[model samples]
Target: MPELAEPIVIVSDVHLSARSNWASKLDRIRGLWQKAGTVVFNGDTLNLGLANRKEMCRQAIECIGQICQADGVRAVVLAGNADSILDGPRHLLLKGGRLLVLHGDVLFDSISPWRRSAKKLRAARDESLRKMPPRMRASIEGQQASVTEAIRIVHDRSGKRIRSRRRTFLENLVSLSWPRQILSILRAWRDAPGLAVNFMETYSPQANCLVMGHIHRSGIWHIGDRSVISTEGFEGPRKPGVAYVEGDSVTLRIARQTGASYQPGKVIGRVAL
Candidate 1:
């Protein structure tokens, strides 16, 4: 495969559904795409539970396809926890594996039991779908609907409660002293940064930086020589964020909604890998 070009844009947790005005949102970031050589949907771009998965994915692809075609940029889509049942790239490796870009769900595998269980369920669903006859499986709409319903059942069972608890735990931990917070992250639920560090040490020891989305909080943290970067969710009230990767440097940019369009805001954080 051809290598991705510089000034790559990594967007995560878009959570686009049938009701979302995602095309307009994409228009707001048109400049970024126009400048970018490659644009990556880091993950969770489609919220499978909220709409028919096939339709949602189709819309997302069409929207992104237009932007890439217009801007002469390459587009890559990665699957996140919400859409893990889908078939697509799950992560991207950059700069000879020095930078790892993923959805950040792997970090939560050990932090939340529900997430781990849900992954297993997703695997089972993928397997079942694989076993279906070619003709039956050819109708992506039916298969996606079934997968979405399965995900909804899993989310209803434990995912919602797990998220609430995780959020509360993170908030309380952040309120503590820096040292205490580190200790809490090590002892209890690993925050995004902690989890990133752990994931790197265990799976990709050579990776110096991890750019991920899923936590819905945009920030940068350093652990020794390694760094972890997170972007804000694209759907929520929190400022929508995106990460700009240029070689070994990464910068986080949030968008400010102005009437019907959005303009890039301040550089919230920067890190050098």
Candidate 2:
């Protein structure tokens, strides 16, 4: 693939669904696109896997396409756990292989350990890997395929839940923050950076910086020679973040609210290639 444009901005887990604030923030999102020569929605731009939300996802994608049509702007979408069915690449190597950008779900066997279907998804992933050719099993393609399979299983298991148009506070709280789920979330957070380093060591050893979003906790962690940067989810307890990629440097910034929309705010971390 060609080199990404300079001043590339990445945001993930926008989760543009029926209940999201996207409708009012469309202009703000467009403003973001206009600021950077290239804008990458790193993952979970929408829940395209749901049968009930297909039209909503389609509209969101169309809006994105329209924005990208403007002069000097480019948009790239990398598939996440929620939208793996979309035809988007799961990962990208940038800055001549010194920086890697992906949705980050492929780094775990369960894809999303905090989800209620964690064990089933983990088992599905293992089964998927076992079915692959032995040599390809360790490749990036293999990992991505397994993650996609796990997401497919999640869709199958949550079809009814997804189809429901309304959600109460208790329902949402239980699904997002039950005791078991909280423990799983903490474990995943603790393990993500190391997993990122191990993944680079296996496939792209030269890449010293990894940029991803999933698990929702955004921050930078330096482990040995590699730096793992996660751009937090759009809707979360902690503030969301965006990462800017420029010549030989990557900077992480919080998504600060400006009137009705969010834009890159304070710099949290910077990595030089």
Top-TM-score structure, candidate number? 2
Give lDDT tens digits, candidate 1, residues 1-273. Answer: 469987888888767766777777677666555578898888787776643367666767778788787888888888776766557567777888888888876565322223435455566456655777866555433344335444546666675676666557777767555674445444433467887887777667778899988766777888989998887665666787778888668888876667755566788888887
Q: What are the per-residue Cα lDDT tens digits for candidate 2 across 1-273?
A: 787777998888877766655645455655555568888889888765441366767677777767676646787888898888777698888988899999988888888888877778889899989999987788888889888987787677777677876788897776665888889889999999999999999977889999999979889999997999999876677888888998888999988877767767899999887
Cand. 2 Cα-lDDT: 0.82
The per-candidate count of clashes, in order, stands at 0, 0
Compute the lDDT for candidate 1: 0.70
Model 1: lowest-lDDT 10 consecutive positions: 109-118
TM-score of 2: 0.88
Runs of candidate 1 exceeding 4 Å displacement: 50-52, 110-190
Determine the C-alpha RMSD for candidate 2 after optimal superposition of all C-alphas.
Answer: 3.5
> Which residue pairs collide in model 1, if any?
none
